[model samples]
Target: MQPAVVAHRGASAHAAEHTLAAYDLAIAQGADALECDVRLTRDGHLVCVHDRRVDRTTNAKGVVSTLSLAELSLLDYGGEIGVLTLDALLGLAADHGVPLFVETKHPVRYGGQVEARLVELLATRGLARPSTKEESPVVVMSFSTLAVRRVRALAPRLPTVLLLTQLWPTLRDGTLPPWADHTGPSVAMLRRDPEYVARAADHGHATYTWTVDDPADVELCAGIGVRWLATNAPAATRATLAR
Candidate 1:
């Protein structure tokens, strides 16, 4: 079977990362799904930005949560590069009939804002759905277990992916990390331990790794039975999977 390919930040390698343009390119290349990081603006709107601050991706200089969506929109998010909002990204996904895998960044600081807004958006747009055990699509993933759990509560039908960088001693801990009191284990440790994957599966959640860019790492993840591999280089990873 062909491993599913998710476009990390929407074909970020060719276009500006996290912009609508990047996402469109990824879809044009026949990607199965689109991935994005969600952050809250000052006015409590969900935006498609990876960094906590806009300095790197935009012309603005402030925390994303501190700026209103109106302020953020005016800041040339596409300044010489890529820029997009959660709404725009979702709209594109809907138009292309592609699935979305949204990751909530800095869930600790944003509290329930990101999840709440996401639920509202999906509900309003009629994008939320229940995935079968064999064909779960449109997943919501996060390093924060709490965020994932919150999403589950808000929309039980929607599938969730637990993003990790390390392993935890307990399955419940997978929902919250020690640093942020958020749940979820690390993908790094799961790659090294089969038991970790089993534990995550037992909790009714799928495992996915992030920022994976190496062929060997992709092979290792595939060997470990991870359902998703989030990578910056989707085309290269897809080629590796083809082999």
Candidate 2:
């Protein structure tokens, strides 16, 4: 089977990352899944923003947790797009019938409240747990083992992905943390150790390689039997893999 094409921060290469416009473009491009980074504002509203501070992606400064949702709405992302709420993003995904890969941003002021609130939000939408894999449309991912574990505790049926930036002792064998249902590795890590993919598969773990915008990297991932390919260029990646 062809690997599922997951859009990283929507079709971010063509539009502002995490904006509704980007997500709409990703759906139109036929991405199998949409990925987003989740952060909590000071007033406890979950938002779809990648950076700790809005300065990088928006026209404002200061940490996400230091600003209220209303305060965040005043800033412009990429000068034209406004900040997107997690709730609004979910609605867009639901409307398009595309699955969501939610990445919980780390070092937030909220201790474990991020996961808790995420679970609550999904539960409210009747999406926290699904009776079958096809029925589930959301997956929680994080670089923090603790964060993923928290998701497992609160929403047992929700799939959890452990994102890897660098090889750690616990994951040297291509196994994930106990609570993680899948593994997400950076493209560089997979390129550095091609065998890691097979090792992970041997351990019954599904490997998803991220931010693969290059054609060669896409070929490498397809050759390694990765189950998911997260990329900014989903249309091109899907076409290349189809061949």
Candidate 3:
């Protein structure tokens, strides 16, 4: 079976990252899930933003952790896309009946507060925890082990993904951190060690790979049985997988 095609930052290749436009396009394109990076605003609200600084994706400049939700609202994130709160993004996911892969950015001043706020928000939508992962509409992912642990602690039944940029010594033995529900590796790392997926599976951890835009990489991940294939162009990736 083809891996689920998740739109990384919501079809970010066609629209600006973290914008409603991108997510809407992703939903329209039949993306299996929408992915986003969540950061805490100064007032403790969760916003969909990849970078700590707003200079790249927005017209104005400020640190996301330093700005209030209202302060962020003034900026032009993209044409008609505007600033998107995790609340609004969640609504979009609910409306479209698609799942989400929410990544909490680490090393922020808010620290565990990021994960806390994420769990709180999920709880508000009755998504904090499900009886089983198959019933979950969202899954939390992070490169920080602490962040994943916090999520697991706050919501034990909530699914968590531990993202990998490099091979940690322990992972060489094919076991993920005890707290991680799944493993998310960068496409480059997966290319270097495709066998890690099988190894990880041997230990019962599913694999999710990010930023896979190339057709060859898509095929590679699909052929290797990646559970989720994150891409900037979900439509193209899905089409490639279809072929």
Candidate 4:
């Protein structure tokens, strides 16, 4: 099977990251899915953002949960890039016939607001129904297991992927790391230990790795049978996988 090419934060290379323009461009470039990082606004609205503070990505300074949606809307989320809300993103994905893989950025800080709102949004978009396979494709993912679990509880049919990094610790005595307790399994660990991937698959979860920029790394992930590949250079990653 062809590996699914997920545009990291949309076609972030060409357009402003996470903006409608970037997402549209990603679809135009033949991406299988679009990836987004979600955070909660002060007023409980879910917005697409990568950082805890908006300074890096937006023309604002402050925590995302501290600002209301109305206030956040005033700031340029893409900075010189373009800004797009979660709703706008989902709509665009639906219209263009692409799937959306949403990653919750700081679930502990935002509580369950992001997952709850995402579930609601997906349901409203008719994506919650398993009967319709092509209306709007969506999958909620996160480094936080709590966030992923919340999404699974709300929408069991929706596939969830666990993002991984190498820094996480192993479970020697059934004791998980502070971050691992919150996140599903680590994709990096999965690469290091095939048993980790087997355990995750046994639990019915898909695995995905993030920010993969190296061509060799992309090929390695494909060889491992990872379901999703989140990369900054989608075109390059896709090319590498094709090889």
Candidate order by TM-score, decreasing, is: 3, 2, 1, 4
lDDT tens digits by residue: candidate 1, 68-157:
877777776654443467887778887888778888886447798788888888887765654452343467778777787788887777
Q: Please name the candidate that would achieve the greatest lDDT relative to the true structure.
A: 3
Q: How large an RMSD does model 3 have?
A: 0.9
Error of 1 at 63 (Å): 0.9
Give the C-alpha miss distance for residue 237 in model 4, angstroms: 1.4
- Against the true structure, candidate 4 reaches a TM-score of 0.81
lDDT of 1: 0.71
TM per candidate: 0.82, 0.96, 0.98, 0.81
What shift in Å separates residue 5 of candidate 1 from its native position after superposition? 1.4
Q: What digit string (tens of lDDT, one per residue) describes model 4 on residues 192-227?
A: 664554454554444566666677667766776666
Report the lDDT tens digits of candidate 2 across residue range 67-162.
998898888998555579999989999998989999999977897999999999999999987996446899899998899889999988998889
Prediction 2 global C-alpha lDDT? 0.89
Which regions of candidate 2 fall more than 4 Å away from where they truly are? Answer: none
Between candidates 2 and 3, which one is better according to TM-score?
Answer: 3
